[model samples]
Target chain A: MTAHPDMHETESSVREFSVSPERLRLTPEAIERRIGYGDESAPDNVRAAIEEMLAVFDSADPFRCGFRILDPGQVAFHPDRIVCGKVIFRTGSIIGRGLKGCSALALLAASAGPDLSERGRVLISEGRELAGYVLDTIASECVEQCLEHLESELAAATASWGWRLSNRYSPGYCGWDVVEQAKFFSLLHENFCGITVRSSGLMVPLKSASALVGLGENAERKDYECSLCDREDCIIRNDG
Target chain B: MKETSSILQSIAQCIERGKVNRASPYPPDLRDRDGADELVRRAIDLGIDPQEILTDGLMTGMKVVGEEFRAKRIFVPEVLMAAKAMTAGMEHLRPFFASSQATHRGVMILGTVLGDLHDIGKRLVGMMVEGAGWEVIDLGTDVAPEDFVAAVERRPESVVGLSALLTTTMMNMKETVARLKEAHPETKIIIGGAPVTVAFAHEIGADAYAPDPPGAVDFLNSTVAEI
Candidate 1:
């Protein structure tokens, strides 16, 4: 994708976006789907639990999202590696194939902050496992919704410049090694969006997500093809 | 005096229906009815056999839950509720087991392997195993292999359950299992997670692999039967 002449930028740019809990809504159906409740509605007690958690969420502000956009000239895609700016990401073949033909990469991170995660942990420790589990599910859903909102906004902005945004692929999912999360994080400012990767490669706050999206004329935003990936335990595949 | 059989049956019913206490408003169908909490306390006051309460009441109800979960007739929420009700009943029985007046079916040590901070699945297994009348010592998440070795050393007879959510962390799970086995070859280790499979379990030399909490419970129960 060629950058608009008027939009010429010589270096990577970082953008921070804050999303309110209300702005990122989750439906009962979405919860049911995430819990793998296929072809059946959640039980009444489960619905009651969800309603209670939603009430808590309604008053909570836990989402913070930010991304560093690498200029096309500084991005390179190999058969199994992604070079963004000065960093090399061994993202494996699946991500390589996904990002192929793209001119730019957006390394984005979204988190459900720390409060909600702490609350969920406290609930579980207090023997309220169902409520804690429900809260965790809601947080995951919210983070994804935040990412979707960011993606939609970027698509609109890039579409005006005749560029397409590909589907975002995370480090831990598909064939991408999660250890590359360190390299991915290196491209962003310290604690961007208040997210941090542990030595084990687990993102702190636990309810956070990081991914890379390709932007180019050939970049396609297609439905996630679970079949193309070998990770049968992926939440998206299980949720779908 | 209430017929003991009827009370035990009621306790099982309360557990299966997820009626925790009289005040619990869950499972609307059982609202305002005596639940597992009251039923279990009443059973204990009446001098019902604690083992019988565990085997015939809590375990029986949880057995149905396990089968339902396996068949996909119920999901995690239902299982969670059932486990909660079972917990309420188990509280009344805890004193007996603690005093050796009653016995657990077995013991199991559970944790999310090192590098994996995910604990929801591990906690679910702990609840299920405890509900099925086994003593569960949950080591929590991000547990190193040495921790597993130490825990197993303390409770050599206990079955060990290792969990991991990420593929990268699953490697840590393999390492944890290997270390535990090398230290205590007699220890039976069961592994589970999203990425875990029967083949992977075999490859890792684990005694078993369960895809869900109920599967873990069933596997533990089968091991007890084997013993």
Candidate 2:
């Protein structure tokens, strides 16, 4: 529970850490107000501030490597990395939840086009695509911590179930809705780990993630999921 | 209610009203007076056993909040306030609980299923469950199947709860639940959070599903009784 000596001085120090816990209590009301401002322009002062801070994000590298696919819809993309595993996972995932649960939906919402490629590929993103990729690194770090804490508890749950995990994948990864997240959420019953979309399909926990990984037998296909990806050019996507 | 009953009842009322302290401006009616924290402390100094203080005072307060949340009379922020009030009372007894000087109602291992990383909902559940007298082992978010199975192995009879906030990750809950059942038949599994339903709970082969914290506590009480 001890903070690393210079942890407070590190770049990882985001807004949450700057406030005292007594003053830092986040509220649902705040989240509700912030949830669907995707297309709304930031207030002038806010825009001025964010554009400055956005650079920290813009200069960032792709998460070691990343990829593209909206699953079955053949639109949007998600680039991921295992970063760390077998113990704990420290990772982050990023994408605009906009008016849909996944960016794939966002692209679909704004796009009207056909794929010349037989595989259903389309170009919808603005240039400087690498900026979008930086979020994956943050996601990987966040995920790594989540996995670590989970592992500690699981170690106590089954007295050692002797099971491991499969690499994480999304529904649309192979040809699923990556768009109809509502379907998969209904199945989880936690609504993608307890977050959900509005009537318009905007996901709450704006920067959160939803993935699918198998156990034992299915995980053996990790490499299969990797090689079959649509963003074959993505340099950060975990090949394993 | 008599003096003791009134004191306990007051605690529950304050919690339901979201009055945190003597100075809290919330529930303007209760302005400038002791809330759960002060009342709970006074109850302790008056010679009440800490455990009864918890079950009768703090737990009762939490029960009201949990019910309100279930009824949609309140949402996450309000529920969180009530929980914070409950914790204010709980902080007084942490050492006792830690020393086995007080008993935790039961143990719950909770987490968000793998491929999902939303923790607010899961954290709320963990906090409220812990405040309600259970020993909560929170695994944060994005938990994998092996993690669930492993935790069960360590605490054979403990209850397990899974959370998922995304549709994509929710499917992983079924995979996780299936894996846990395959590994430990006796482990009681409960699933909850925004998109969950009792029907979906059954679909995953889970033993129970609570839409909110109180329902989970009720199921836990039953599970403990059966033991």
Best TM-score goes to which candidate? 1
Alpha-carbon shift of residue B225 in model 1 (angstroms): 3.1
Q: What ranges in model 2 sit over 4 Å off?
A: A1-176, A179-205, A208-240, B99-101, B195-199
lDDT of 2 by residue, A74-139 (tens): 232233322111211111132111112221110001000011110111110232111222222223
Clashing pairs in 1: none
TM-scores of chain B alone in all candidate structures, in the order given: 0.96, 0.87
Candidate 2 chain B has its poorest 10 consecutive residues by lDDT at B72-81
DockQ, per-model, please?
A: 0.62, 0.02
Give RMSD to native, each candidate. 2.6, 19.5
Q: Model 2, retained fraction of real contacts?
A: 0.03
C-alpha DockQ for predicted model 2: 0.02
List, residue by residue over B1-227, the lDDT tens digit for candidate 1. 35889999999888787889999987888889899999999999999999999999898898888788778788788888888899899888888988998899899999999888898788778877887889999999889999999998899999999998877788887888889989999998999998778888999899999988888987898898898
Isolated chain A: TM-score per model? 0.91, 0.34
lDDT of 2 by residue, B75-129 (tens): 5546656766776778787877877767887899999888666665676678678
Top-DockQ structure, candidate number? 1
